[model samples]
Target: MNRTLTNTVKPDVISDFKEITKMRLAVSVVFSSVAGYFLGAEVVNFVVVLLLAIGGYLMVGASNAFNQVIERNLDAKMNRTKNRPIPAGRMSVTTATIIASLFTILGIVVLYIINPVTAMFGGISIFLYTCIYTPLKRVTPLSVFIGAFPGAIPFMLGWVAATNDFSIEPGTLFMIQFFWQFPHFWALGWWLYDDYKRGGFFMLPTGKRDKGTAIQIILYTIWTVVISLIPVFGVTGRLYLTPISGVLILILGIGMLYYAFKLYKNKDEKTAKQLMFASVSYITLLQIIYVLDKFIRIWI
Candidate 1:
């Protein structure tokens, strides 16, 4: 009876742990990093790619776990986050801390084996996400701006992992993702303003869900679209997009811009939600287009 009960209870623990680490979120970040790796690698090493994915997931997971630990109280106040492990009383702080520390150490070790620069960027991402962005969320709207730095790193870090260099190419990748995040997150923030306020997070630039915030989202959407096209000019070192890819990315960006404009025109929660979904689609499709273009160039 005892053995059977323990077996049944284990799955619950696993689910709670996964919740604390934000597995789906971590996986999306890993996908971006993997795309970067493929773009920068001249000859892909499957083993190194595997290490990068594992290490990236570990680092992101650790950061998320730490964030939950720090924000357990605040999380409990928010409807969306109230069910998280720490906030829901499903996991102890001590257990979460141990898991986070283990993940951090293991992640860094695996990345370091690839290259010191890769490991260094991974460590910085975790520190910024957990130590800086987590606390700053309640203090100022600029927290989202600061958070974009670490958020953008995975795209560039994967490039560094592939090339083992810090150059204009990686910087371009970083810049693209960095700009993309503003509109993406701000739109989501607009839709979830009430929930975010419950947890004392000020994610929107204007600190209110109004025309001002929507305007900023629109402007950043424009910038994101423009900057994404820069690589097609052949100015960003090794990062060059062919005109075909550029047009596809342009179409994708325009789709995001359309929704951003709708949010601007309406300033409504439903439009903001639509913009949020469009932003997600924009980035994912853009990444796919980029990888496909790279492979096309290689084949030709």
Candidate 2:
């Protein structure tokens, strides 16, 4: 009986550990980093790209674990988060802390091997996400704004990893992602307002799912679309898209805006959910487009 229980419990523990790290979200962040690497790299270094992906995932996972540790009690109050490892009592704070520490240390060391700038940005991303944004979620609506900085870091960090420079190109990538998160997160906040309120988190700019919130989402969506196209102007120096890719990005941006408009008009949970999914699809496809356009321009 004891041996059977141990075997069962061990697998459960491992699953819970993965949950605490928010593995899916971490992996997505790594994908963005990889896209940035591809966009910036003239000669792709497969080994460095691998390291960036690994390091990016570790830092993102560590940030999520730290967030869970700090918000365990708050998380327990939200239906969506109550089943998470920490809130569900499936994982202890001490264990999570150890995991976070190890990930942070290893992630920084791995990035530093590529360049100190890459490691510095990685550390800053973790710090901003865990130390600042996590607690600010309960204090003010600006937490989402603060969180966007760290959220945008992976995209720029990839460029820094490739070139070890913080120039106009990476800055443009950072801005594009920075504005994109507002609409994306606000749509999610709108749909999950009740759960977030129950969790004592103030994520929406307007503090409620009203016209004010919807308006902000639309505005940011516009800004995101505008900034994403700026690179095509060639003013960014190292990163410029061709006419075809620029049009593709414009169409994708409009697709996201269409959902944002629908959410505004309907002001319902269903519309908000659609907008949330659209936001995800928009960013992912936009990143892929940027990478593909980068190589296509060379071939053409």
Candidate 3:
């Protein structure tokens, strides 16, 4: 009876931990950082990549955990977030706080082992997300703009980790992800506008699914495509893209742009969700293409 009780409770505990950390989102963030490491590395270092993956995941997880802790009461009001561990009453505030604190300390220590610069950026990401972005969400829509800073950091953070330098190469990487966030997140905000309003979060720029918001999404999508092509001009230091890869990336951008325009025309939840999915695919595939193009050029 005792053994069975322990076994039954263990899975619930693990599930709660995964929910608190937002394991899938953390893994996706780690993937972006690893891809950036590959793009910046001259000779691949498996150990450093492993360390980056671990440290990046921990830092992202810690940020998410702290976010949940800060927004626990607000989260309880939203249908989407109401089931989360903290909001659902499965986990106490004190327990979640302790877990978040442990994650923050462990994550920083792990990142610091890589180098001071990498660790510093990791710390900044957490601080911006928890300290600045979290509270600002309730007050204004500018929170999304501020949140993009931390969201954009992981990609370039990997470059800094591999090269230990801040230059045009990492700056280019940063800008690519930075401009991409607006359309990506705004689509999500549009789809969940009601739920977010319940949580007292202001996510959209215009605070509604209006023509103004759709136009801005289209504008940012255009900016994302343009920034992605800059490396092909041979001006971004070591981050040059071949013509072939540039064309392929252009095609992918056009595909995402199609969805962005669709949302603008339809102005409905389903269309907004489609744009959200397209934006996610666009960013992920863009990173993969960039890394693969670099490796292919080196091989030739």
Candidate 4:
């Protein structure tokens, strides 16, 4: 009986840890950082890359855990978030806070080993996400704009980790991710508008998923596509892309843009959800293309 109880409790604890850290989302963030590392490093360092992945994940996870703690009560009010570990009574606030604190410390130390600049940006990401964006979510839709700062950091953070410098290359990477977030998140905001409303969170630009929000999504999508092509013109220093890769990225951008337009035209939950998924695919593929292009260029 005691063995059975121990086994059951162990699994529940592990599951709760996953929930508190938002494991999938954290891993996705780590992917972005690793991709950036590859793009920036002329010669890849596998050890540094591994450290970046671990540090990135821990930082993102810490931010998410802290967010869950802060929003536990509000999360309980929303159907979408009601089943989260904290809201479902599977975890205590004190336990979550302790875990977040440890993650924060360890994440910073690991990133600092890469470079001071990388660690500084990582710290900034956590601070902005937890201290600023989390509270602003309930007060204004501008929170999304504020949130983009931290969200964009991971991509550039990897670049800084590889190069140990902050320059136009990383800045351009930052801009691309920064603009991409508006369309990606606004689409998500539209799809989850009703659920978000229950938590008193303002996500959409116009706060009601109307034409204004759709227009903003379209504009940002356009900006994301345009910025992504800038590296092809030999203006972004070490971040130049081959003409072939540039054209391929443009095509990918247009594919995502098509879904954004669909959301604008349809103005429904299904369309918004489609755009959200498209945006995710677009960013992921774009990173893969960038890394692949660099390797191909090196090999040839």
Candidate 5:
């Protein structure tokens, strides 16, 4: 009886935590910081990574909180997000607001200690996502475009924090992530267009499933692959591309595009889900490959 009670109660507690901090969203944000850090840091700094992990959580969590605050009603109408804390009435607006505010302020402070540049971008991402992008979602499908700015920042945020400057390296990282977002999110929009329609979100250009959006996905997927190879070409300053790594990246790009075209051809929910999953794998693997390539080059 005691063990069963603890297990049941534990889920409730975990769900509450997810609601408060938007754990799923925060995990992505921290990843950005990690990607950025690895690209910029000349030497591994555990302390910096630690601070970034926590601070990135707060910054992304704040955005997630505010997103829920604004979209609480809309979320309730969607099956995918219906159980979210705010939509489900599990957390109050007032408490969520306070928690978000505290996290934002605390998170920025932590990043500021690392450097003004990291803090500046961190602060900007929060403002853009919460203040600009969140409101824009209801008004325009272009909100996804606007949101990409903040979304792409985390992968480059570490470079600024470690180097305390904006340079081509971080720019490359930002651009890579920026292009990656369109295909990834568009796949999601395709998958969840039904739910989104109920909430008045104009996610697809056609406002219905069609080839136009799928073509855009293929274009972006192509662009994403092209950009992934730029660093290996040694053309981007502070970024170099070697032959072996180049071949590996090309193969990976093909994998992503294969699935992208599959979605484009079928335009079914299952294909869209596969493309979405493939995209996640693409980006995460790309980051890992970049780090590995760096180690190989340095070692060689």
Candidate 6:
């Protein structure tokens, strides 16, 4: 027992946690889950919300850890990912594998305690992100859509976790994130096209910085704004966009669309980067606006 204990694994648990979590990505996903919960939850259920947050983080983090493990070699070829913990040799493949499995199991169990639907989505998200997305990246640009399905789930998962049911409200959340991905992701594609190319990944549609891709970005940006305002209409089938909230969302969406338009018109690296920054802020702000609008209605 002592000899086995001596040989038992010891790691810099702190750094390993950070590395396995893709700390920044997990943080962003958690914020989205919280916002989605607030936006859709009519009654605040602190316990379920907390579970969803932690479960969402663990599941998403596991996805990222497995991705890094699979792509360590390809990541080493790309400037952006060359310094990742896996490729940079700070963490071993064995350690990463164990962490990924534990997170998935723990995350699903937590979500299951909240509600079966939450568990289902969380499980599928981890599966899609790892089994589907990780490999698709090396195969096709269509992987973006496949990956977006999992990426877009956080928005809806929060709503379902809160209501213990799936409904159009969560669907609205899903659509917003779904449409937002095109411009947001394509903008990153523009900025990192070269780095991605070095890794043999064609992320951009045009496969080159050209008018076609720019036009596509503009179109998707517009679509993102359009769907975001669906809550304002009385005739949208259970989803009504109140006039005031509609206007606020419109302004926010237009703010984002304007940047997308600028990037399309300019087709320069700086413009593309600016659009990417705007898109990040745009989604975050949109979620804030949604939650605020929901609260404002009750208060007013």
Find the candidate with the highest lDDT and give its number: 4
Per-model TM values vs. the true structure: 0.97, 0.97, 0.98, 0.98, 0.95, 0.92
Which scores better on TM-score, 2 or 4? 4
lDDT of 4 by residue, 1-300 (tens): 999999989998888899899999999999999999999998899999999999999999999999999999999999988999999999899999999999999999999999999999999999999999999999999999999999999888889999999999999999999999999999999999999999999999998878898989999999999999999999999998999999999998999899888888899999999999999999999999999999998999
Which consecutive 10 residues in model 2 have the weakest lDDT in total? 12-21
Comparing 4 and 6 on lDDT, the stronger one: 4
- For model 1, residues 1-300, the per-residue Cα lDDT tens digits are 999999999999888878888898889899999999999999999888999999999999999999999999999999999988888888999999999999999999999998999999999999999999999999999999989999999988889999888999999889999999999899889999999999989999989988898889989999999989999999998889999899999999889999988888888899989998898888888888988999998899
Candidate 1 has an lDDT of 0.92
Per-residue accuracy of model 5 over 67-174 as CA lDDT, tens digit each:
888888999999988998877877888878988899899999999988888889989999999999889877887888998899899988888888899989889999
Q: Model 3 — TM-score against the truth?
A: 0.98
- Report lDDT per candidate: 0.92, 0.92, 0.93, 0.94, 0.86, 0.84
Clashing residue pairs, candidate 6?
231-240, 231-241, 232-241, 232-242, 233-241
lDDT of 2: 0.92
Candidate 2 deviant stretches above 4 angstroms: 1-7
Clashes of each: 0, 0, 0, 0, 2, 5
Predictions: Cα RMSD each: 1.1, 1.2, 1.0, 0.9, 1.9, 4.0
After superposition, the stretches of candidate 4 with alpha carbons farther than 4 Å from their true spots are none
Segments in model 1 whose C-alpha atoms lie over 4 Å from true places: 1-7
Error of 3 at 198 (Å): 0.7
Worst 10 residues of 1 by lDDT: 16-25
